[model samples]
Target: MPYPLLHAKAALDELKLAARSAPGIMVGVTIATTALANVPGMGDAKANWNSLAKALEVEYPNLIGNAVFLSRAGWIADDREAFLNAASVFSGDLQKLSGLCYTMEGQVDQVRDAYALYWMEIGLLAATVLGYLLACQAMKLTPHLRAAGEILLARLTLLTNAMIAQKTKVLYGFLAVAGGTLATSSQSLGQLFNIQPTESAAINFERAVIPTDPPSVYLAPKRELPARPKQQQR
Candidate 1:
């Protein structure tokens, strides 16, 4: 029988759905960090935070002229990155992205009713952007580690999908391979327990053993502690 167009495409439908939903997991974090990026003289975290209370002061001005805007139009879109990008511009706090205190402020908010919230969003976004950039840079620069991460991620995806399908035999096979490889690597650092061409498990069972060695850190420090009496008077 010929496959229908929809049937051929259904395999990735769940993955696409999951990807769409996963973006929300980080949305709150982005929004929160963006708000914190906008406060002025924001260094010395303690001082910045103290001033932030005053900065956050949103008073009723009907149509105030000195207000700050964190999310645009009194609110932000659900897309965290876009919201953060806007907040950074609104506060003029890119330096905050470098872990430095932002000393700039914008007077674009006409309501004065939202300065506090705007200030907060800018601060939060600055921190988050810095963190994201650092993480992305590290991941990009480290290829071996990145490969290891990808392998682990692939295994997780496999496990999740397999578990849902109840194909436990495949899961068990994967576990066996993983466990055996790890066991082999751990048990044999040199030539002893490694599998050899003429070796049989029945004949090699006795050779599997770990060596005993004094850990380097446990060596005497060359300084002595005074001895305590074995028993104290009751």
Candidate 2:
């Protein structure tokens, strides 16, 4: 098996694990978003929550597409070195994505803490002061979520393009090998039969006349010229 296929299989396995684990994380995000939306003073933060949700929606399908492509056996690296380079890039992207997930998780925790604090402060502070504080926290928390979501989308796009490029390289390599094999086999068979193949008439004709020659002497012009000079001497 190709090294790239092996790497893809490993990636697929990791993706499977991620798929299993994702719902729990998504549930947390959903709950947090819902909780924040209900909180009275979230203001423009609600739009950010909606944007994050839409980003996640787009991200899940892209992840699924990555898995689908990786599962394909045809997307192979041409050599061990190629596989190593691809694997390095893929691993780095995965690490970046993992870091973003961790960051998002921390952001979610912050939102939860803010939610809890809202209730605590509500009891002691005036309505106007409490609303202002909640709005301020929303302003800080929502931007981080949006940025992380955008980064995740970009990483997924890169991964998808990398897989496609690997597959294309493998396909071209296969075609080159096939063409070489066919030419070699044809030459071997010709030698074994002691058969010399003549050039096709079209090829012979093309070689017989230079493009600079007049059209009247286009056919075998060199042979025609020698015979014409002999007849004139006679």
Candidate 3:
């Protein structure tokens, strides 16, 4: 019923997420955009931002407009108008939210690929270095192809497993953080909708803030302050 608060809360959520992921996202986008921009005459680095915005607009073009219309039509509460200023409650914000999520996932995948690739490359580089070292140590100066190959394979497997474990830990940590956020947001939403915690939580909140006198004080026989004696009539 209170549309402004509802929309404000949603917008606030996007803002918080944006703030949280901003640093990593900036790194990812910088790397990604730089990588993408190097392709000669691609001419659409910004296209991603536009495409995402348009996609969101397609989904919710009337979001801000309708919220405005609702306010004018006396459908929403007065206090809630504060949320729909000139800039907010629009598809752009949602798209930003979507883009942030998309870019984050993209970055994670890129990093994963890079991690695997780097480890694989490290194994190759190490093998090459070790191979050269061995060749130098040899009297015949010919590398042992089979022995080097075996060592490389064994090292590669071990490195891959270690990387996998690290990635697994990261993925699980992401899940835990994501899950906890969702749970908190859901709890907030339930508070909004009166779906969870029943009446007791609110009552408890009130009691905590303005606590009742102890039961004994209320229950004990009260010693009333002596009534002011009536002034004698002149």
Candidate 4:
């Protein structure tokens, strides 16, 4: 068995829900953060909330790209060290990104109880995404949340979904831009792993020839009479 396949699979299974809900979660977090941005003491920290949200925007695609790389790496069944090391490093990167969210959430909470609660919900969303990466790295799923926590998470999820439903066009535009970013990231990751297109999928870069001829051709007329006259004189 590969080193992390089973673990990664399990974590992915768990994360699928989170991944599907990320946009809504981010929308909620954005609304909450914006609401609290003007609160006392949050002046310096306002940007952090937006930054965390922006970071999260790339996270889903990053995970998907990493999963593709991991799968390709597994199939190739070579360079385990490189793959595992990259996975380890990538997991740390995920954790660090999550830490930024966690910190911003904490700072928001410090300003007011309502803001704190709002951010705690955001933290839960962060945990759902980052927790899976951590689980993949440790090969152990995090413990389930208590009943109360589950209820709150569910409600927040519902609220975010409703908000998303009301703002489809905006989310669509955001996702379009995100899709472009994901393509770039995926391309870089493919290069890192030396991933190539399958035979059927390979591109033909050879230039095509366009057959054409000149519109007209010109030739000098022979001076037959002059030539005859010169021979007669000779």
Q: Highest TM-score: give the candidate number.
A: 3
TM-score of each: 0.17, 0.23, 0.27, 0.24
Off by over 4 Å in 2: 1-78, 124-234
Superposing all C-alpha atoms, what RMSD in Å does each candidate have to the true structure?
A: 34.4, 28.5, 20.7, 25.0
Q: Which candidate is the best by lDDT?
A: 4
Put down candidate 2 lDDT per residue, 1-234, tens digits, no spaces.
544233333433433333232322222222222322233323234445445544544565466557655755654345445655665565555444444444444444444345444333322222332243344345446875656544553444344334334443544455466546546644653554574456563355555755644567445423443544545554
Off by over 4 Å in 1: 1-110, 147-234
lDDT string for model 4 (1-234, tens) is 332233323433443445453334544444433333233445446566657645654775478567857677434244566776777677665555555555555544444344334434444544565554343333322345445444555565665445534343443455466556546644653454565677978766686465566548765555666544545555
Per-residue CA lDDT of candidate 3, range 5-32, in tens? 3333343333233324222222222221
The lDDT of each candidate is 0.38, 0.42, 0.43, 0.49
How well does candidate 2 match the true structure in TM-score terms? 0.23
Instruction: Summing lDDT over every window of 10 consecutive residues in candidate 2, give the lowest-scoring window.
Output: 28-37
**Model 4, residue 172: displacement in angstroms?**
44
Instruction: Please give the lDDT score for candidate 2.
Output: 0.42
| Sort order, TM-score high to low | 3, 4, 2, 1
